[model samples]
Target: MLRLRKSILTVLLAVFTLLGCVAGPSLSAEKTALVVSVPMEGVVGVSLENYLDEAFAYAAEEKAALVVIGLDTPGGLVTSMRGMSQKILSASIPVAVWVGPPGARAASAGAFLVMAAHVAAMAPGTNIGAAHPVTASGQDVPDKELSRKITNDLAAQMRSLAEERGRNAEVAASMVLNSVSLTAREAMEIRVIDTVTPDLPSLLKWADGRKVRVGTVDVVLDLKRYEIRTFEMSPRLRALHFISRPDVAYLMLTLGILAIVFEVLTPGGFVMGTAGAVMALIGAYGLRMLPFNWAGIILLVAGIIVLVLDLVVGGIGVLSLFGLASLVVGSLVLFRAPGGELLNVSVGFMAGITLTLGAFFILAAGAVWRSTRNRVTSGQEGMVQGEGVVVEDLAPGGFVSCHGEVWKAVSEGGERISKGTRVRVVRTDGLLLHVRKVEGENLEEKGAGHK
Candidate 1:
């Protein structure tokens, strides 16, 4: 609940910063300027890479006065982050990277991007630093030589970005080397960032006449323009971003299986099957976009197949047991990419899902198999040897009340029976039942109807 509130506040701050920045100014006084505000949130990925390309291109072509980016991210791929920084560096328009909404922090790769911007700003509650590199598992590089190499290279990167932006390069190096961090106020005091802003109005007002060198030309920012246009990513990107989280993506894949299972359980249904297929596809796409292990996927699928077969073919807990093993092994290594700890899913979550699904399949299938072996308790065949009261006298064949139903009965033992006398069924032929008297006498009646 707290996370949700934080996210909402961040969004509001970003939106207000863009829309209300430099307000109270006459837009028509000078030339009309288009200010493009782009929100860059979440972990960096191919989706982010594409969004950046689109935003930067549009801003350049439109000749916007300001490109305000509301950035709140934990950090992501170094490669993607580097490409984004390069895009900002080469852009003809000035880029303002703002870490905002009080609780927001630009750690790791985010810090690199923040320092690379032409104008770096932050809200009071935000912090920036922790540019150290770790493996996908969130551990220092196991190889000592490799660890030193990556650290030095990354430190160089931080220093270059900070120096280029005219910020504090030494402090930037410490962020990478020592995993140091600074609040918005401290960062500004140390000259690591240009300024601190409480809100969008203050940021824009402060930024009004700042001159920034873009490529080969020095451009002066004019914030007199009142029009603020926000460019959002495509719907496709939005969908991808939503499922990019390790937990959500994993759930999509696992839940997709249950949907398909339900469809199979209730065959010929269209909705569940289609939904399962689509969810699985989207989940698979999300995995492919991340650092993925194909082996894990194959094992996971194989486990599901085995479990399904066990249910269908009535395996005595054998196939399902093996399936459980496969699931456990596959899940552990599923998202173990190069630096997978950054995108790690909880072990408890994976184990619980696996156990729940396995147990359900085993219990439900075993119950069904047991039910098929139970004795037949209904129909005419079950009525053999059942005792009934005679409704009419039976000389050879007459109606007898058998199992609460009137049946055309014949005396196979050649016994005479009176009306209301109890008789036991001997056998059945078509709709007729052969009977004998309770006294062991042969019952016979001439009439078919007993009245």
Candidate 2:
């Protein structure tokens, strides 16, 4: 009996050991390391700001040890860039800005963002810099005095960020003041960035033991054996991001205005009005977010207004031709980046849209307008003095024949008329007509009315 008990204990111990081996990783014995990657590409608009807010907050929510921002963008709005910088400056988790995948760049506002990160990294063949401040037309500060103010301000900002990160401040300032650019290797050699890592795994590997100061707290990155979770922009933000592009915003504005114009020219369309209003509002919001030339915007609006007015006041397409010219010219200079470069929307694109919209207003609108002006052939109301035969002998309220149909009619002058008396419709209140007998119109026995 004792031998049997020993054998059973041995069998139980072996079975338990096998189960433990299979379930060890799934158990809550060790801490779960978290890392999150956020895409920081394109024009840094309000949508990108909102996304960054959510992403940083999520890092805190998930207790993430590292937050990586994959960046590849041209410079964007200064307001949005400043907001992102502040968020990064105040974040609890260490944020690493990586300009990745050979040939990508973090220019202008992107350079500022990278400089602000705890770990500024880049991939080989990528570049950064060209931090100059220019107008939408690409001109630098207008005069020496203005240039001094702009340069000094940007230099001060770059200096502050570089000093905090312990990087080459003079180089960074020169980037803004002179619009200098550099490759990843050149940047690393000049101490602009910490390292040039080719991939995320390599970046994480190099960052494993690094120390970073975030919001007055010094922390070490614990990236070993951590799972990276990529947080993509939400659908709402994605759509907003898409619309925030200058070219897309311009297209939406044009299409929206044309749709609204179509509704006005051809009235009684609820669908067109509702859709046009919504799209126009969205496009306007996008333009407000972007760096647009307000003068061009005003000219565009004036062109549309003049076209509409000409249609209303009657013209031989003369004002329309002028308005078309204004629209085309306004569209050409609608927006240029501070670097003096227009968006990549082709001239052919604008020409096609302008021609199509113009044709609709000129041809379709003209046809519809002409059709409405022909004649009023059929009606029940406003038939006063219209010749009609009294179908029933009228005392006060009786049926009268008019417009090939009998109407419940009352005598306008309250005169008693015989059944054969010819009558005229005075007016109509609902289905009842107020009519009176026509004078000298009862010539033929029963059929003769006014000729």
Candidate 1 displacement at residue 326 in angstroms = 2.8
Clashing pairs counted in every model: 19, 2
Cα lDDT for residue 174, candidate 2: 88
Cα deviation at 357, candidate 1, in Å, is 2.9
Model 1 error, position 123 (Å): 0.7
Question: Each model's RMSD to truth, in Å?
Answer: 14.1, 10.4
lDDT of 1 by residue, 1-451 (tens): 9999999999999988877666635444477667788888888776887898899889888878888888888777766777888998988788988898778888888898888888899999999988777654455667788778888988998899999888899999999889898999999999999999976667777888889888888888887654678899999888878787666677788778757876887798799999999888778888766776777777787788778878778776788889888887777667766544233245677788889988987886787678668765567777787898778778877889876788888887767778877787888888888988886433433333443
Structural similarity to truth (TM-score) of each candidate: 0.70, 0.67
Give me the runs in candidate 2 sitting further than 4 Å from their true place. Answer: 1-32, 137-148, 291-296, 308-318, 328-451
Predicted candidate 2 versus true structure: per-residue lDDT over 191-250, tens digit per residue: 989999998889999998789998888887766677899999999999889888876788
Q: After superposition, how far is residue 333 of candidate 1 from its true place, in Å?
A: 2.5
Candidate 2 displacement at residue 395 in angstroms: 39
